[model samples]
Target: MECIVRPAQSADCDHLMGMIREIAEYHNLLDEVKINSQVLSADGFGGDPFYQCLVAELAPEQEGKQGQGIGKKLMSEVAKLALARGCVEMKFTVAEWNVRALAWYRQLGAQDKTEAGGWHCVELGGEALQRLAGDRR
Candidate 1:
């Protein structure tokens, strides 16, 4: 299957959201995903945009079959978009357990800063965040 990478449009909100949900689920982060079609469209196509997404589609090869090149294509496009949007660099985090993804990102020239301590990540989960939110109410 041939793959074609392109910029995402407002019409692709549903498909993008579906992909996002799938990825989140794959990473055991389904509960952390709160994105919907409306939110995706508004955030990506609205004023004061937070981020952008790239889409991959079949290039009409061999009975119009599409393949799974979306992730790579999207990564490339996101990097380009980030640079174009005045971002000095782009950043993404991968779980320490996701070796496949980590390898792929490294292959794409993403540096592994695991030893640098330049980045700090804070995650709220397992009822603590919930309790905190509830206590504030």
Candidate 2:
């Protein structure tokens, strides 16, 4: 079996958007999706790029196989990119109830930061963000 982990391009926006919706559906949050493929393409490949991401594409014929490892491969590539970009740490949130994701990340030496280092994952979005900023519009 073979796989590829590569930098995302504008052409991949649609596929990535599909995956995002799929994941959102898996989490029962499909209604929260507000962005589309165009937004993803511009933000990712625009003049003032906001972020970087990697894409993993597995061999189409590799089915009924054990240990696909597509995600680990993608993360390894992203880790390299982060290091090259002078980042100290990589961060992303996973739903605590997603046992498979939790186990996979733990296997890669990730820890619950709150437990290990007394760090917390905090977020403020939408109304909370505007309220905190004292913006009424």
Model number with the top lDDT: 2
lDDT (Cα) of model 1: 0.78
Against the unseen true structure, what C-alpha lDDT does each candidate score?
0.78, 0.84
Q: Using alpha carbons, what is the TM-score of model 2? A: 0.86
Question: Which candidate has the top score in TM-score?
Answer: 2
* Tens digits of per-residue lDDT for model 2, 62-91: 652336777778889888888998998877
Residue 31, candidate 1: how far off, in angstroms? Answer: 2.3
Instruction: Pull out the clashing pairs in model 1.
Output: none
Q: Which stretches of candidate 1 lie over 4 Å from their true place?
A: 60-70, 123-137
| Residue 126 lDDT, candidate 1, scale 0-100 | 65
RMSD of each: 4.3, 2.6
